[model samples]
Target: MHLTFTTLAANQTHYFLALCLELEKQGYSTSIISFHEESNKLIADAGIKVFNVFEIYRIEKEKNLNIENEFSALLSKYQIECPNILLSHEKVTFLIKDSIQLKEKFVLYFKALEKFFNELKQTHQNNVVLFQELGGFASIVSSFYVARGMGYDNIYFEPSFFKGRMFFVKNTFESYKVQENFSLPIEPNVLAYLENARANKTIVIPKKDASHYQHPIRKIVNTHNIKRLFQKLFSKYLSNQKEEFNYIGSFVYRHIRMLTNRFLFIKYYQPIPSEKFVYYPFHVPMDVALTVRAPLFVDQYYLIDYISRNIPNGYSLAIKEHPAMIGVVEYKRIKDLLSRNDNIVFLNPDINNHEVMTRMDLLLTVNSKTGAESLMQGRKVICLGDAFYNKSKSVRFVDNIDNLYKHINTALKNNAPNIDDINVFFNSTYSQTHIGELYYCSKENIAQSSLSISQYVKANYGK
Candidate 1:
């Protein structure tokens, strides 16, 4: 059996390597299909076969044939549409004007992956793919399509309900664990962990970038992005030119937008803590939660319009800017876009998340962890996206704009938090989750994570 690691970054390479090495001890041949050159060398150093994209890129160039058509057909066949938000984001300005370059890059990527696929069939036995996240980004999404099309089994490792724990799911957008007779988490330690997290009211920011953005100055100081600084400055002055350095302009706009949001938040978005409100914790625009799972709900402003019109008379719609996007979007711009009649109140992002959840008359989310966390509190949640907790009776699922009003009324009027349901969900999640943290975990935690991976493989694929 070949354990092929298809991880995203060089930072995660060590952790993926740890799993591969542990499995290697059990008669499994190890391989890595990576974009990072350093990761290729590291895997090779560990006596694992390395399949780097540059190697395939080299092969493609030597072919002297433009395989862009073939690559486009493959992407079309897989229905792989690169996220539109990428072209506009300032940090990674790969896609600006002439989306042709973006398409060309992905075409070559898929072509390299085809070469790698051919090699996998000839050199490996019982091959399987491992990914941290699929269907979220461009290159990774391309890899997922290529691998799945070639008839390989994939384990899409997902973050479990518990922080630092993980579980296997078929897809990121539509995964729901079906288990009956729910009880509290079987592990005493796991239960304690949840209790502590709830008591302290810690918000789990999904991406490392988001956690860093909490303290923007420290994030900037630690980051060696001076090159981007100049790029942002020059892109603005060269706006008349075709998208050569538009990322520079976009970058400059992003920081300026952040400052603007801070100013707007103070000036216009002041929400009295004592007033009745319905919470809608905003999400990172780039996340799969919105882009992949809830594409229609991508425009929060539209949903806000619906909520503003339909919410009960006394309850104000309190929306918080997603911490991840605080530095990216202009909050004042969002506020000014709405008419004065839209009974809306914007909450400061810095406020304790649990306080926001607990105080609100109702918590509405488009597939956020806020929904799950709210449910754990026995609080009724109005979920707009397909979420793990949508099945809970306490959660009101809204699928259409026409029905959102009815659903909100139903949830608000009759739904009360069920402590028993919360306990059951919590227990089931812990009992099923493989104990370990995915990133920044201690050595012991890594070992436990590897063991969890091994267990899943043994249970599902082993003879």
Candidate 2:
């Protein structure tokens, strides 16, 4: 079997390298398509074939082939719906501000990816698979579309709701599904984790290193990252590298904006209200969880305003910043929402999420894990977007926002989920998930994750 790994960062590069080495022992060959040049060098040093995407883009650009009707033709040829989310990726919008430039660049990327995938298909045929870390960035998204168009088996991986487990799916930002008759015995640890979460205790997941938020300044001052920053600076100015993405520039801009917003808006956050309230936690901006999975709720401020206007008369809508985005979100928009909506209140970002859930009458979310957490706590939840736990008996999935009030009322009137139903839902999830971490690159994690992945491929693809 031949595996092609897509790596966008240093951590992912390390993780994929470990997977490649482990899988090689089992007679599988591996290659890499790296979006970051630093990752490309690291992969190459490991004695593996690595293709840099920028080099591919440059090669395709030199052809100067007409792509005037390529986008429409590609869609028709591949039977793929227009990939709006790929074009809307933050990297594309941030780097190419002009509309004409953006379209030209996208067409060039599409052409390059199509040609690259054609060659890969010719070489590996049905023996190849593509692995991508879950993301909404341009390169990954474009690659996914092109690979699917060329009839390749591609899997997107992300950390699951359970600790130390990962889920894989084929569609961008889609959740994994288990057979309706899934009958695996529920793991005792899964039950224990649910009980602990119900008691308002912290529950750790694979991607989380700690339960608390780390300040942006602390992240910037780290020795390894500082060294990386310097290396990137040198590469940008002193080297002849043609990079598609500016990692250092994006990092600096994000943190500077984060710090400025933190200083200016800390005073505006209020405590969770004593009155009866329904909670709405903010989703991280530019996160695939929002941009790809729930594009309708991308402007959360508007969603909040709509929710506040329709919520039951006696209940207020309590909102909080996502911990990962404490200072990263735009405060002016939040300020405008707060000023206009009297029924809405901003909770301090420092408040423990479980504590807030315990005090709220209901939870409202756009595909957030908090919806799952709220269900564990026996709190009624109304989901405004696609979520892995949307099938839970405790959740009310709202298909249309115009009828938001009707759903809210229905959820508020419904009883808490039965323990048996919760068990069944989680047991189904466990049946679908493989025991592993996504980005954690510890030796034990690497071994376990690689074994799980290899077993899955062997069973599914007979490789």
Per-residue CA lDDT of candidate 2, range 1-463, in tens?
7888887767778888888888888889888877777677778888887877777677777876566565566657666575565556564325334444455566666676776677777788868788887777767777787777777877988777788888888655576644423356777887877777676567454563442256666665668667877777887778756444555677777767877887777778888899999999998767787877788888888889999998999999999988766777787887898889889888888788988998999999998888877877777888888788876665787878898898888878878777677777776777788888876888899889888889889888998
| Number of clashing pairs per prediction, in order | 5, 0
In order, candidate lDDTs are 0.65, 0.76
lDDT of 1 by residue, 1-463 (tens): 6667665455567777776777787766667777655456677888777777766655566776555575558657766565343323322332247655555555666788777777887877446654554345545655766777777766666676777676676533365553534533356775676678778887655333344455444434444566545544453355322122234445555555566556556655555457777888877665666766677776767777677787877778887877666644445446564555456877777776787888887888888888888777667788877777777655777777676667777777885877766666677766666766665546787678777777777787772
TM-score, per-candidate, Cα-based: 0.84, 0.92
Pairs that collide, model 2: none
Model 2: residue 54 alpha-carbon error in angstroms: 1.8
- Model 2 has a clash total of 0
lDDT of candidate 2 at residue 35, scale 0 to 100: 72
The runs of at least 3 residues in candidate 2 whose Cα sits more than 4 Å from the true structure, single-residue gaps closed, are 63-73, 91-96, 171-173, 178-183, 208-212, 242-247
Error of 1 at 299 (Å): 2.1
Error of 1 at 251 (Å): 6.7
Which 10-residue window in model 1 sums to the lowest lDDT? Answer: 86-95
